[model samples]
Target: MTTSDILRAALVGRLTENGTLTDAAWAKAATAVPRELFAGSYFVPIEGSTPTGYRTVHPADPGWLEGVYTDQTLITQLDGRTSPEDAGEQSVTGAPSSSSTLPSLVLDMWQRLGADAGHRVLEVGTGTGYSTALGAHRLGDRNITSIEYDPLVAARAASALRAAGYAPRLLTGDGLDGDPEGGPFDRLIATCSVRYLPMAWLRQVEPGGRILVTLSGWSYANALALLDVTGPGEATGRFLPGYTSFMIARPHDRPPRPVLALLPGEERASRIDPAKLDTWTGSWVAQLAAPSAERMGSGGNQILSDVATGSQARTVPDAAGGWTVVQRGPLRLWDRVETAIEAWQGAGEPQQDAFGITVSAAGQRVWLGSADGPGWDLPV
Candidate 1:
């Protein structure tokens, strides 16, 4: 077998062992797409290091192809601007803007989406064209429309797709808006996370079609939801089990806030441990409790600041055997979070699967247990 073939087989073997590729057509497509064509030189972030501090790996580098075949996400862009090719061997410092998502998650989501040969799919966030190629291969290239927001990234993905001999309609625009001219599609799949379901997606996708996306918020807590468009401007769905997250949609990202200034505030013994803010379930509940707050710090050092009102809460160890929380501004950030934590706990700490969503022209609302159960209006 050729090196690419062997690499592809090994990758598939790994994915199969982990239960990522259940559908045969998708597995074949995964083996067919040359991930290296899309990734090229990529960045590997140093763990617990500066966000932008990464080592660049080129095809010529020893074991680079092996790295490509590894079941891991590869960083492609930093700070929304720089690619590894732009920075070369240097370790730059910034947030990762784009990536080739881990293959297992990619295939898992695609499998759950259930788009088939007859279905025309609208795919959002065509980051590396890897997922796009899989979609194009499984369905027909003519049956797929992939939208990418970053012009440079879109152009690169286009080049990669052309090299791979597949051509899907690639649009350089916000995926949230979808493709107006090309839609009313059969399925809408988003690779990025949004705070709430977009009404545009509901309108663009035909009634009874599926919309798969990650529901995320300012806190970056996220869950994958599969919504079925029930009518014009309406859809309802439930969060699937398992942990899933994507980078927050660019437009839905919180606005830049002032650098943290730890100011003194109303101090009291904390009713709940600040450490809860760092756990997966706790973070999800805390985000629901204070939907507008951006969380920072970790464990007992947790800090939460309201993005809109400038209210802040900082936790410190109390000499009297518990934690002390200091609060400032009009909004009591900790109080809201504590209430949410209590609610989630009272409900037996249900998993994300117990949550569901309803979307309409009015807005989207996420609820726990049932449509008539405890819920919150997603900030649209």
Candidate 2:
């Protein structure tokens, strides 16, 4: 077999053995699509960099092919413009704007989506077209429609898909808006996270269709949900088991902020340990409690800055054994977080799956245990 074929087979074997590639159709599609085509060049982070730096890799480099086939997300663009070719030999630093998502996650989510024969699918965020190729392979090119926000990224993905001899309807527009004209699709999957389920997606999908997406916020905690559309402008589902995250959709990302000026207003002993915010479930709870605040720091040194009301909360380890929190502005950020965390603790500190979400004309609400339980309204 050719080198690409051999590598692809090995990847499929590893995924199947680990129980990630459960669907035979997905396995076949994984084997057929060449991932290296989409990841001709990528970036790897430079270890131990203070601000985080990345160096470029190319096909000519040793282990490039192996790295491409490995089940890991490969950074393809930085700051929306700098590609591997642009970085050259030096380390470059910027926020990751696009990537070829880890193969295992892609395959697993596709299987979890339960897409079957003749189902029309709308894919949000066609990053490198690798997942798009797999979907096209199994469901036919005519049945898939993928949308990308970055025009440059979309153009590159289109080239790669064409080279692989598969073409689905590709659009260079905001995935958050979705393809309205191509409406009533059986399934819609977002590769990016959103602060809330977009109304456009709800209206575009037919009743009884499924919408799979990750809900995230300023704090960056993510919860994956698969909602069954009960009717127009409405859907409900419980959080899926396991932790999953994706970059927040650009439109839903927090706006730029000025340098924070810490203000001290009310001070009190924290009801719960401040270190809890560092844990996965705890961080998610804190986020649900203060959806408009951006979280920073970790452990007892946590800081929260409210985007809307300019409210701020900061915690520090107190000499008296527990943690102390200082709050300022109209919003009592720490109080909201403490109450939420206490509620979560009262329920035995359950994982994300214990939570459920509902999206309706009334608004998006995330609840612990059930719909009537203690819940927080998502800042839509």
Best by lDDT: 2
Once fitted onto the true fold, the runs of candidate 1 whose alpha carbons sit more than 4 angstroms away are 48-52
Best by TM-score: 2
TM for every model, in the order presented, reads 0.96, 0.98
Model 2 segments more than 4 A misplaced: none
Cα lDDT computed for each candidate against the true fold: 0.88, 0.93
lDDT of 1 at 260: 85
Candidate 1 residue pairs in backbone clash: 52-94
- What TM value does model 2 have? 0.98
lDDT of 2 by residue, 1-380 (tens): 99999999999999999999998999999999999999878999889996999988899999999999999999999987999998899899998989999999999989988889999999999999999999999999989999999998999999999999998999999988889888679899999899999999999888899999999999999989999999999999989988799999999999888999888789999999989899989999999999999999988899999998899999989898888899999999999999999999999999999999999998999999999999999988
lDDT of 1 by residue, 78-106 (tens): 87998989898888777777899988998
